[model samples]
Target: LVQTWKDDSSIFAHDGRLNTPYSDHLLGSKYCIHAKGFEVNTARVGDSLYYGCVPVILADQYDLPFMDILNWRAFSVVVTASDIPNLKKILQEISPQEYSVLQANVLKVRRHFQWH
Candidate 1:
């Protein structure tokens, strides 16, 4: 799915028929992949929380926001660069019971990601 999204230039292109809004995608997705960009922090994390989507962080040596205060592991899944190939396996290993707990924690921490 990720590969398809990357290949379809039309998805991001200005004149595509399926140029759906980003927020619309987030709302429909269960897990939102937060890849590392030029900056250490990105708005993708906040966007994931805003829509109640679990964040799958695919960054190496990246410091998450509010790390000192928030226990990120409780809400998000952290995958190292080398483990990219095993992402599907890792996510599949998470039982439905555990997934539910993680999702609930995501909601609990949603307020912290909000700005006044």
Candidate 2:
């Protein structure tokens, strides 16, 4: 059920090959790991704030619903795969200072929005 362009798909399975140079070509990426299965969950859970890379969370159901368990916006943005184009614009225009403000707002929401 892996979704990918036909040409891109074959090259991956040609010899149990994995990983892509495409992620490497991104504007400021230092490293990128595009993976499948349970490994995806492990990767996301393991990432830290110092990672710096803006993780484009690809999972929908488990992810979208799971955010209710904890306040995670301290370090991530959850966007659907199709909305990546608009996300790219958001990433470009959102300055570091503004991003910090957004993080601070998230903390505020976490502290105040809790149910008593």
TM-scores, all models, native as reference:
0.81, 0.41
Query: On residues 1-116, what C-alpha lDDT tens digit does candidate 1 reach at each position?
Result: 35635565433212234467888877877777777776445576988988999888887888888999999999999998889878767887989999899899999998898876
| Candidates' C-alpha lDDT | 0.79, 0.42
Clashing pairs in 2: none
lDDT leader: 1
Residue 58 CA displacement from its true place in model 1, Å: 0.7
Cα TM-score of candidate 1? 0.81
Judge candidate 2 at residue 14 and give its lDDT.
24
* Local distance difference test, candidate 2: 0.42
Off by over 4 Å in 1: 4-18
Top TM-score prediction, candidate number: 1
- The local lDDT score (0 to 100) that residue 42 gets in candidate 1 is 50
Worst 10 residues of 1 by lDDT: 9-18
